[model samples]
Target: MTETVAAIVAAHRAGTVSPAETVARSFARIRAHDDPAIFISLRDEKEAVAEAEALGARKDARHLPLLGVPVGVKDNIDALGLATTAACPAFSYMPSHDATAVARLRAAGAIVVGKTNLDQFATGLVGVRSPYGIPKNPLRGDLIPGGSSTGSGIAVSAGLVPLALGTDTAGSGRVPAMLNNIVGLKPSLGLISTAGLVPACRTLDCVSVFSLTVDDAMTALTAIAGPDGADPYSRNRPLSEMTPFPANLRLGVPRSGQLIFFGDKASEKAYGDTLKRWTALGATLVEFDLEPFYETARLLYEGPWVAERYLVIRNLLASSPEAIHPVTREIIIAGARLSAADTFAALYRLQALRKIAERAFAHIDAVVLPTAPTVYSTAQVLANPLELNSRLGTYTNFVNLLDLCGLALPAAMRPDGAPFGITLLAPAGHDAQLASIGRVFHADTKLPMGARGLPQAPLAPLSANVAAEEIAIAVVGAHLSGMALNGELKGFGGRLLEATSTAPDYRLYALETTPPKPGMLRVQAGSGSSIELEIWALPAAAFGKFVAAIPPPLSIGTIRLADGRGVKGFLVEAADINGARDISAFSGWRAFVAEAAAG
Candidate 1:
């Protein structure tokens, strides 16, 4: 369908296609598809085409990044001139303006094709909890589409649109992506303004993007992410420029005891294969306990957070309880019985669990987990709605509670032909980092884009326009991605540049520190081996502060790269190496540590 935003923009710029033509093609596809369950309401073809024609007429159309792109907005978000029903006709409202995120897309020249259906009020992970018919899973009609962003996911997956907006309080954004075979990006909370979104656990809700590729999802994120004065929850975190993944990333996976597949052998094998793929790509997998994270996840539904969901429709639930879905009403009404003490007790427990979750990240660049433990057929989920819906949130509900960002990318297809996906998760503000790795990993799979039958395309090159005041630094040990001190680098807004080796003239030593660190020492020619290292770019202004924070025995100095370039990097003071263990045989800190653990 020529759905990618980049391809459409390039075609327009090359004079091969016009915005009006693209919009017309979008309408034609929607009409041909004829899925009444997909969209609650669609813009009239004439109105959308007229808007596209007007955009094409602008002298600066080329400056608009999303020119001619057609996108679907989840019905929960307000789009001007459309009724915002959130899949519940009883609660529909007409908004005079677009949501801030929607406004940004329009500003970038994206046409709002329609308001897609969702699980009513974003309540269920299963797609069937709505008055509107369930959005059919494009891959197999018998499978549940996955929700609450069901229609948005289906629209993009089926090629009716290349991009769609969704919201993730638990797994709304990611689960649907997995079932549909697409990319879903749940940006760090407060990164994307939620100003016009109807409340659904307001504090945890994030405006998410769904697209055919990691690059496309990222493009939409770039266009929409920012602070909004109107949204008090919005923060001022600027999006980091995209960079290539560092060579030696450490990804955390659940320990064998913690890996749950709900008896689905296909899903189990798919996840295992995906882990092997990550290791093959030069990433180290660290197994960690998932108990604390699971505890945090339990709080989302079992604790007082349900109170927030109830608050969204308190009056309606009281006045017309029968009007809502019976199960949804039961779930929300449970909040009314909770005491204030129960809320505080849950908050206290969450605080303790959050600390444990944060420690899990100290040794990994990100956590790689199955987006959902398993998939379900429509009949299976319908038969056991409550139990199955809770099960779907197994790997997703804890994300917002832990204040993490996640990227869900298609990894492989199961033996049975259903798609399998893995999510890369990191602490808040690491959205771009997840994208950097996800793009490369997704491309490696060579999977088609969703159900469109189009081969995955190469990612667009990262922007070369670096900020003038940036400095590149080479990190060798604890400061490397996914290591103990890695947060210090990320905290200062550092972005990984590359994973390469230093000139074959340095010896590495394990220093005497609490968690241990490595120091690189220059040696005589031909006597040393090329040690693995990673280069990171940080704002020049923050470099001094980072350097000054280094403890004694480790200092910043120039280190030569294999390609004959030099950069400021970590090195050991000559005197400090006296008591340190020479570990040059292992070549890198990760290898040495891994071997030590094995021994």
Candidate 2:
């Protein structure tokens, strides 16, 4: 069985394994695996071992987070000594410096073992698009490994490395992880710097993480996530501490008619089993209309976003058309015909769709969907490239477009022995929240680590560091996770503590504000409901600033929790509820807004 990041770090700290020994073990596995397509280029064994040896000599080496952990870098991300081919020989170039994300990983003591393969210029969802032979799927060799993060997914799944860096544009990061039965974390756009990455769609591209477990993925994210001064899109978003999943989470699922399994009964069954597990774990499944989300997904390839892809290869497309993959080239060239009018029209449509999305999210904390509708064999995709590739993006293409963060977890194994996975998505800056839920869900399944057939390491106690320095505030309405104006909390460096409910002494009212706001007021215990609310921790210094920004009728006050604790939360004055609609029966602001949207 392959060791996990936590296990490796523990072993290193205890002096059970030296960094040089671990690096050697990784190379041994890489060679023994005999998978040429998994890595396009690898660091020299002696060079990597020497680097590890030097790290081991440092006085503070044992204190490094990822000390001695081996990692694979997607070829598209610049690694100091490797040539980034992005699986295109003609476009390969040696980089003098590491990508911002890679630099952070290295600084945390992670050793870059190699550069993995990918779809040429990251233009396809099916792994077969690469001219480099397809990386054999670790679970099922006949099945396509999913791409364009093909090799990175395979390496981690096969235990060649516990962590790997992949780039997500469309479904490159997530689809591969699902197909390979590993964890994929597509973070909020700009959360991880893309400064040294080759742009697939500059505005939409994100450096993604792949690991054997959600904890490992989160560890890598913590080490690498932050803003880079050189990257214009980099953002200084706040990351919350990992806490337990809420007791009664409202999760949205696509309506029955909206699910598209594409005739794969095994996948359909796997998803059904997953839904049952979620319900069993105390999540309230809410079915919602997915038409708007699907419509938005179509815009990714059908609209001006294709122009962004064209921008990356315009010069190459014109100078050496034959150098690019035929299918990938066909897709990029279409952008040349798009008019500026076409771009703005698509942008306008997206703005309208975003409003619909916001309304949809107001009803649930996160949306759960199959990572990919179905899996295709290499031969199957080769016969029908365009349709199969599009199908793979059914649940993924809208993520970056809508600026949401996602975490993919292995859910079940199909009757046919194929791996099946689901992704949890939320609005931007909810990366930590997704990980919190994802960790619990992944552990509940008790699935083995990737394809290694080893039990997952026991979950460690969540660090309560964020709670120590910040104050937890309960929010029930527009400030709830994924709702409108949630950005204000994020702007104050707030972190979601957990989703919980207020005491049974509170009544909720929908106040008549411009965008509408919910107000909770203390009432007689027998007359009020325990309303759903999220606890967010804000820095002590910023809490004052956050309270000062509140408008009339809403003010911070001590609110009692169901557990008998009290925290400062949003409240409305008694005078404001006179004409406001009493929505206490809905129990939470999400349900109240959902009912309004449906009507």
Best by TM-score: 1
Give one digit per residue, the lDDT tens place, for model 1 in 1-599: 35687788878876799988988887898889888899999999999999999999999998788988999999999999999998888899999899999999999989999999999999989899989898789898889999999999999999888899999999899999999999999999999999999989998999999998887888889899999998999999989877776778999998877978889999999999999999888999999999999999999999999999999999989788777888788888998989999999999999999899889999999999999999999999989999999999999999999999999999888878888999999999999899989999999999988887788666664543246798888898988888988999999999887777888989999988877988889887668889998888899999899989888788888887775567788888678899789999998998998898899
lDDT of 2 by residue, 1-599 (tens): 33889888878877889988999999999999999999999999999999999998899998898999999999999999899888888888889899999999999999999999998899888899887888889898899999999999999999899899999989889999999889999999999999999999999999999998888898999999988898999999967767787887989999878999999889998999999999988999998889988999999999999999999889888898998999999899989999999999999999999888888899899999999999999999999899889999999999998999999999998878799999999999999889988998999999886877778776765543355668878889998888998999999999876677777998899998977889899987656899999888899999999999988899888988875567789998899899889999999999988888899
Can you tell me which runs of candidate 2 are displaced by over 4 Å?
Answer: 468-599
Clashing pairs in 1: none
Error of 2 at 364 (Å): 0.8
Candidate 1 residue-wise lDDT at 37: 95
Model 1 — which ten-residue stretch has the worst lDDT? 458-467
Q: Candidate 1 regions off by >4 Å?
A: 468-599
